[model samples]
Target: MPVKIYHDEDTDITIVQSKVVSFIGYGNQGRAQALNLRDSGVNNIVIGNIDDDYAKQAREDGFSPVSIEEAARQGDILMLLIPDEDQQTVWNEKIRGNIKPNSTLVVASGYNVAFNLLTIPDDMDVVMVAPRMIGAGVRDRYVQHIPYPCFVSVEKDPSGTALATCLSIASAIGATRGNGAVGSSCREEAGIDLFAEQALWPEIMAIFREGFNVLREAGFSEEAILFDMYLSKEPAEIFERAADEGFVKQLKYHSRTSQYGQLSTMNRHDGKDIREKFHHILHDNILSGKFAEKWSNTKWAAEELAKEWKEVENAPIVQADERVRDVIKPDRKK
Candidate 1:
């Protein structure tokens, strides 16, 4: 589908700033949005969570800290910023009974609402404002005084002002500081986010793990490969070149045009395998126990992984890894 973004001029901020805002969680997006709103002069805001620490923190941040039911009852706009799995329980126990007929319900992610994990009441409006970045980036950029865009979707708006309400809330969270409004559907947002996460995250870890293992097994310095790969010495440089133009530009800059010169010719024969290989890796990993085992041990496993990662990160090969083109760029620029 064609992507459409809404600008500040297209949004109506007073539509939401006039209402009583309640954020249902105190996690990354939750805290970021809630605090940003409060800082933007949004009054009558409350933060609710099961955790005392979270509640206390929210209260410390100048928002009213209330029980979930109280927050839902008092709020004209309720933002569900909790995890997808916990949303149902929160709704059933805390929100369902307190939500007024015309109140608005908001979600940052579309998974629960899209997948039918949490069904809203018939009389209420449902909308989503999903920021494309991770929660940390959202929060950190906010701290750094930068802005990012948020994807918005109105699932159900009996009041006929759902779009306006969503935009108001987005503005409260400082989304207007950037490029602003983008149109999205619950299904589309959920599908694309899930697919992108699955494709980029686990596979990236797998590649890192295999590379580190290979270097270690080769009797080479683990720190070298780890630093080279993790530090992105080569990748960063290539990216800089690519950013200025394209991969070919990067290759030319590095005088490696001849090294990849034959790749274009080989594509006719090997290109067909890319899709098949991706499918095989995806399905095969699922069919095997490898995926599950990766997280099986939880605590101990994560520590071990981190330790290994740290070792690799401190490796010497990290400096000369061919995959890294501009490791110094990130290290020095940042």
Candidate 2:
């Protein structure tokens, strides 16, 4: 089904302007959205928790930072831009009682709401405006007067204007300026995002790593392997061109030999089997709340993440990458 898009014309900016907007974190998304909103003429904006490095940075950026509970009490619209794992704890400890009745509670992602990780009050307006791009991308597009597409969802609407409020927020962040915002359900956004993170990204990384190992075993020089596999700009440039034009157009940019080889080998993988596996991972692991349950213990999650990073750092591919970089771009060596 085609999504209904909402643009600046469909949004009432005054609705968002009328409320005090408090960001509950000063992380990437939080800082970007807050700054964009302020620049877009949302006057009543504040940051929560003036204790961390991010909070100090927010203060330096001209935002008055308050505690989480203080922000919840002061703002009519409270946006939780913290990590997904931290949302439940923060909401339970600092937000629930302090959030005003009938006020709006916003989230950048639907993970917590979709998995029933949060218990939102019935009197509040719970909505989501998930940007399709990164926080830096959102800020860049806003400055250029371009729109970044976003997924907007209304999970609860105790206040009748919940959808409008979400659209208004999208407008402020330049998500409604170009092709406009795509209307979505909270569950759909959460499921897709989680699937991308858990299945698609890991699969891509595995392909790259295995390919690198194969080339190494074939006795290719580390520098040559690194450049061909990734480190060089060619792959990134091709992908960027493909995004701007079309994949078919991208194929035209390459030599006929390259195109023939790529097309011939593309179908070598079992597409149906791979898709079925993706479906299994998405439905059983992500949508079924199994992944969320595992990640609920933030401490364990952090340790696991650190362990993975350490493994990546010590991997042969990464070691080869470092050697190649040192030889070609020694200035980058720390």
Candidate 3:
């Protein structure tokens, strides 16, 4: 027999919606999540920030905006959607001191709690409800009447109502719209989210950077190469495949002739030139203690990568190419 677990729409919404929910932080995850939660009729919500733009935005969107202390005091359910690194400090300074003894502390990711950066009081409820996508995708998917899947985990449920409350909150924020699947556990949810995030972006960036460098060293214009990759042929074809169908369906969309063309292109460009360097780099960075040291320091790897990207973006030919593309946007749309 299949495992019969507990969850459904009839599960109480007012349980969480009635609680004074305070969201701390106002970045990518924070902004989208706070607004989405409010839009779902979670009216007893407070955003923890004094003068931040998200506070302003939250107020405009019909949420109570308060200082972190006041938010913590007023909030029976405190959601920590801040960045991984900053969570500990925030918890120590703002949240831990002010929270009601038996209140709930919700985290979307598990870094601080998993790594023992933030230790919860034994009396409080600790749970996690993590959406499986980034901010834009999460927002867009919700707007499209497609609720993204979420992982709900209850680590320490003193009241035994943590799981139910989390599921209720999930339902409130469109987590059950189109094929919505919600799974259980704090450790499991945190681990999976962090692992996927840590692996995918660096791997893709390393691949792109190496490919761009190799093409440039081979005397091809980086602008020409990226244009072909992004706009002209490669991206267009990929977009066509993805838009027509899902990943498996994409293979069906490609004719045998198209398959042969792909094989030919791979042989000519990708197979011949691209090797295991990106994988090697990824392994080295992760294993060589470099990634750890960088993380432990006050460094932002994504920002640094963005600067390198901006350098490539600032190349004169690249600028001109972008301008030309913009000029033809109307034609492309037509």
Instruction: Give the top-scoring candidate (TM-score).
Output: 2
RMSD of each: 6.7, 1.4, 5.3
| Alpha-carbon TM-score of each model against the true structure | 0.75, 0.96, 0.74
Which candidate leads in lDDT?
A: 2
Decide which is better by lDDT, 1 or 3. Answer: 1
Model 2's alpha-carbon lDDT is: 0.88
lDDT of 1 by residue, 158-205 (tens): 999898898888776767666776888877776666555556565666
Would you list the rank order by lDDT, best first? Answer: 2, 1, 3
List the lowest-lDDT window of 10 residues for candidate 1: 286-295
TM-score ranking of the models: 2, 1, 3
Q: Residue 59 error for model 3, in Å?
A: 2.9
Better of 2 and 3 by lDDT: 2
Clashing pairs in 2: none
Which regions of candidate 2 are displaced past 4 Å?
Answer: none
Per-residue alpha-carbon lDDT of candidate 2 for residues 1-334, written as tens digits (9 for 90 to 100): 8889898899988888888999999888998999999998999997997598998889899988999999999889998999999888899999988987788988888899999998888888989999988888888889989867799989999778899899888888888987889899879998999988888998988888889898889988878887887777898989899989998679889999999899888857668877998999998999899999888778988999999898899888888877877888779957
lDDT of 3 by residue, 167-195 (tens): 77777766756555456665555555544
Candidate 1, superposed: residue stretches over 4 Å from native: 140-145, 232-334
